[model samples]
Target: MRAPHTATTLGSAAPARDGPAQQVARFGRHVAEMCAVMCVTLILTGLAVTAAAAALGTSNPITGAPAATAAVATLALAASMTAWMRYRAMDWRPTLEMAGSTIAAGAVMLTGYAAGVVPADALVGGTCGLACVAMVAVMLFRFRLYASHAHHAPSGH
Candidate 1:
């Protein structure tokens, strides 16, 4: 007679290992953490700008703009980081596209600052933008490093 099955079956088994699903869940958690950190960073930056503006006088339009711009930039930066993390975990092509776009935008922004079009109080906003661009660059480099290491592994497994 056939023996009864004692081990877990297909539907009853746990995940084979931390595969794509675990990677995705990890990415989601990372995104949430990044967002929270960005929120605090932006808020502090805005408050600093506002205080500096008040000291410099409300007549300064640049000071006021930075507070608002910083908030938006921070949120965008968080989103970009999340995308980069996800891409790093699975793919590189789309990440390249995003990194290219981000770098181009960052260049344009830095140009504006170099032209003296940006106000002194809004310098913080420019700094935040640059940081976001840098984050993308770091992510790209990290993926490249890991990919090379993975390819050279002795066995596919």
Candidate 2:
């Protein structure tokens, strides 16, 4: 005699994996952790800048602006690296992109400083702007990679 049909045999069993809600919650948690890292990095960077300014006798508003700008840019780059590590998990491409961008920005800034194309006071702002642009580009590239992967992943996934 044929075996009696069961839910499993009928292909109606529930999935063993977490549902979409759980997946979203986990993603949210990861984002929160990354944000926490960014916050800490920013705070530490600010403290370091403040200390350095005090030590250099440049704590006055006029001189401090450039230092502050440089510090903010460096901290932003650090935060981007942190996010890349958390999300991409040691992927070299993004790291290389970041490094290349930073170096290029520095070179440009130095060249401008030497040529007097950019005033000393404006160097920090230019560097910060370049770094920010580079970071945004990297972020866009990462998003594209993720989108393509998601699109190509097997339906079962």
Candidate 3:
């Protein structure tokens, strides 16, 4: 009275039987995409900060821009983090935690910038860089887990 086991019923392990080469290629594509996202996020954050500083008429744009630049970079980084999580099909817990931490850090940096304790460029650049690095680290960790799973999974055939 039970249904027979089929490829579809076997879940992901069914498709993964294709072998390691396919798995590596899939991971490679993910790595490439992650790199591209990071690059674009950094570039866009820099441009946004520069434009914000210019628009605000900061005398020494690099060091004189308002905390707004940091805020903008934080927004961009949050978006990137969300995208990375979605692409990896990860749970939202880490994404939420990362977003919270990023926002908190950004707030601290903005406060420091406002208090003249840190340069605007440092605040914006450091926050953006840190966020991107964290994202890449998360992606790498996920990939390692995936690879390990694939390695241990039983061959469907």
TM-score of each: 0.40, 0.51, 0.54
Instruction: Assess each prediction's global lDDT (C-alpha) against the native.
Output: 0.50, 0.54, 0.61
User: For model 1, how does the per-residue alpha-carbon lDDT over 1-157 read when each residue is reduced to its tens digit?
Assistant: 2232234548876533444665455545543544455556567655665566678776443555643454445445545554644533524444444445444554556566668886656555565656655654554455433323121212212
List of clashing residue pairs for candidate 2: none
- Candidate with top lDDT is 3
Model 1 / residue 127 / CA error / Å: 6.9
Per-candidate clash tally: 0, 0, 0
Q: What root-mean-square deviation over C-alphas does model 1 reach?
A: 11.7
Candidate 2 achieves a global lDDT of 0.54
lDDT of 1 at 38: 52
Q: For residues 1-157, could you state the per-residue lDDT of candidate 3 as single tens digits?
A: 2232223334455532436786567667655765576568868777766776678776555566546666776877677866775555544665565566567667777777778887755887776666656655655666654333322222222
